[model samples]
Target: MKRIILVAGATGNLGNKICKELIKRDADVKAIVRATTSLEKKETLTKMGVEVIEINLSNIDEVEAACLGVDCVISALAGLGDVVLDLQKSVLDGALKAGVPRFIPSDFCTNYNALVPGENRNFDLRRQFKTYLDGTAIKASSIFNGAFADILKYNTPILNLKDKSIGYWGEKADWKLDFTTMEDTAAFTADVALDQNAPRDLQIASFQISPNMIWTDVNTATGQEFRMQQLSNLEDFAQFIKKQRADHPAGENELYAKWQQAQYMYSMFSTQHARLDNLRYKDLDWTTSLEYIKSFVK
Candidate 1:
């Protein structure tokens, strides 16, 4: 029997990649899109041979109908509390109603299990949904890929490409932060969605590299010989971001506020994958940090 996989948030960045990967793997793919999604986007999905189902997500009957016969539902839905907590619950309820056996939540970031509570709001939302998910009978798995490796393109404290410098916090210059390219993550997810016996959690990194290591990779890839800088210790950086978050109440409503981004930066240096499951799926050709940097540097 062909694996039937249903995906929510099919039009977004990571979500779209996952759909294509699923189709490439020959799964019977279904995408749950908002009724208001543009015609062009729907056509794009249809072109890929995905069954595009437009429904009112709040309507359990409609959602249940879309979920019927689905072997697994993969939610790449992104948002604050409204979508993550409330809308995901609605989706889960419909999956339960339809008797779907597996669910993959949109937890494509650091090993949040290793982070302290009340430190990262975005992670906290995922953590809250996880609590609700654990109480259910459906098999759930969260894939933690650390920060997306794409962040390297953006000039962050860690890898300031424009500045020709790499940096770190406290003594974490050697910490191996997990990073997986979206393409890599999507390919792995496609494999997991078809897996009937996947575990509660699976972690992988296309390549794990420390700040010290990033400097070397950058040099090898670009020959730029980027310099290094120490930002600050984790404790002081955490306190600074806490103050920034409290001082700016308006940012709470936005998805990636400045403090939230800083919180994410803190998380990268703070926690890493205790172990990796990269070899679970044998077909993936992982991208290395050197190759990733080489892509844009030249």
Candidate 2:
């Protein structure tokens, strides 16, 4: 029998990709979308063989009805406090009420648990949800995919493509930063949703390459030998971001503020995937850092 899977946030980037991956594996997929969601998004999901339903999201009964017979509930909803906390709780409540045994929350990012409370604002929200989730009767799995490999193309501080320079905050030039491509993450997530015995925490990375190791790939890809430069000590950089956050008070309302982005950079150098669960799904084709870097240039 095909695995019946229900997904929230089906119209979103990662959610949509996860749904597609489920469909690729021949799982019977259903999606709960907001009534205000675009017709194009609903039609797109419909075309992909998903049973798309419009739910209030706040209505536990409606969400419970939606969760009735699905084997697993995967939430790929991406947002700040309101969506991640309140809306996700509603989904969790409905799933438990409906006796859905397995759940995969939208904890698809760095190992936020490894960082301190105030280090990353967004991660704090997930940490808050986790406390509640742990107390529940339902089984849940949190997939920590580290940084998305797609960020490499954005020319972040470490991978500055324009200046041909790799900068580090401190002695982190050789730190292996974990990165998983969306495709890989989605693929692994789809498999985990189908696995009834998936562990509570699963960490996976397509590649873990440091700035020192990445520069060679950048040089080969662009035919330019990039220089490694230390921007400042990590402690000093942390203080700089603290001041930036204090200066821009309005950024507290914004999801990806400048300081928040800096916090993410600080996190990349500070903590890494202590172990990767990439091999859990033996068939997954992990994307290498060199291939990803070359893709950026191409």
Candidate 3:
């Protein structure tokens, strides 16, 4: 029997990829899009044969109706705020009411379980939501996919390909940061959601290498040598967090929050708190950082 999968945030980067993967697997795919979504996006999804339903996620009734026949719910909602909490809660409620057997929350980051409370607001919000989900009857799965391969293209403080430099807080040479491409993460997520016996929590990493290894890949991919910058040492990182707290006392400033989150994430990567589940999903052909970087490298 073909499973009906309802994808929230289907118009988003990761969500759109998930929708495509679901379609490729012959699943009956439905996308719950907000009324504000662009017509062009909707048309594009329609062209891909996705059933798109426009509904305000804030309206419980509408959300519930959209989830009626869905066997599973996949959320790729962005941000780390109360709005995200409210929307996801609504989806959970709707799924519960509709008897959806599986739910995959929009937790496509590092293993937040390893981070301490009050350290990272974004991760804290996700962890709080997971705690709420645990108290419910709905079966929920969280995917911790380290860093996205696309981040290398961005000017993020973690890895800046444009600048040809990598940032670290501690012993950069010894710390191993894990990463997976957005495409691979979406594909793995679709497979997990479709599986009836997948675990409650899964971790996947296409590449787990040190900063030096990343530099090596960058050089090999682009045929150019790159440099490494130590953003913070152990003591310096602690002080950096302290200063961040001082700058954003309430932790409400989005920009400052992101900076602090990056620092905390860098620390997490250095410690290697999460276990990798890549071996379990042997069917997926994961994409490495070098392979993805080489695509655009001249």
Candidate 4:
């Protein structure tokens, strides 16, 4: 039987790549996407002859109807809305209702335990969703890759030179967080989702990386002296937000709220870096290197 795999958030960068990878392996895919997603992405998938359907993540009934007869579900759901948690619930509900056997939750970042309590609001909601999954019949797993290499899309100073500098948060020099390129993560995900013996909590990645080491790589690659700005004091972010809101009163409201929530959650990064070893998936032939990551910087 040709396995029917449904990918939520399929129009997303990672999700789109995953769908293509699965198709490359001869799997049938149904891309569950938002109606508001870009037409370019929709048309590209449509031209590929893949099935694309409109889905509102918040609507569990609609999601269940979409999951009918699907064997597996892979979600890359992302946003700053309450649907972060709700989407997981809806997926779980729909998967169970549809009698789907396996689920890959939207946890392609680092380990959940690495985030200290109250740090990273996303982790808190993710933890809640994980707990919900634990009580369900559908087998579930969360893939962790430390940080998405594509984060440069947001002009995050940590991975780019927009401000002529790079700042990494964490403790001592030896702390290495796991890293998986978006491309490799997508490929590994497709491999695991199709593999008959693949287990839950599969850690697939190129390797673990330390900010200190990454700093060295940045200097070597860019040939520019990079300065490291460490946020040691948790309160520093609070003051930063206060000043930012005071300066841009017009569109600053929503951004300020997001910044405040992130500040509450990511402060744990200042002290410790949670390192994950994803070498278990080496047999799957899905590993990229720091050298490979350099190509995506542009």
The C-alpha lDDT values of all candidates are 0.91, 0.91, 0.81, 0.68
TM-score for every candidate vs. truth?
0.98, 0.98, 0.91, 0.79
lDDT of 2 by residue, 121-175 (tens): 8899999999989989989999999999888878888877788789887888888
* 1-298: candidate 1 lDDT, tens digit per residue: 8899999989998999999999998999999888899999999999999999999887778889999999999999999999999988889889999999999998888878888999999999999999999999999989988889899889988888778888899988898888999999999999999988899999999999999888888788767788888888888999999999999999999999999999999998888888999999998999998889788775
Q: Write the per-residue lDDT of candidate 4 for residues 1-298, one digit (tens) a residue.
A: 8889998888878888889888987889998778887899899887776799888867888889989998889988775335557776787788789889889888776566555555455666677788788888887767766666555334564555666555554443455555577888888888777765666665544665555776777667667666776744446664664565456556332423555434532442443334343555454454554585466543
Candidate 1 clashes between residue pairs 3 or more apart in a chain or in different chains: none
Q: lDDT of candidate 3 vs native?
A: 0.81
Superior candidate under TM-score, 2 versus 4: 2
lDDT of 3 by residue, 31-101 (tens): 99988899999998899989999998878788889999888999999865654688898888888988888
RMSD of 1: 0.9
Supply the global lDDT for candidate 1: 0.91
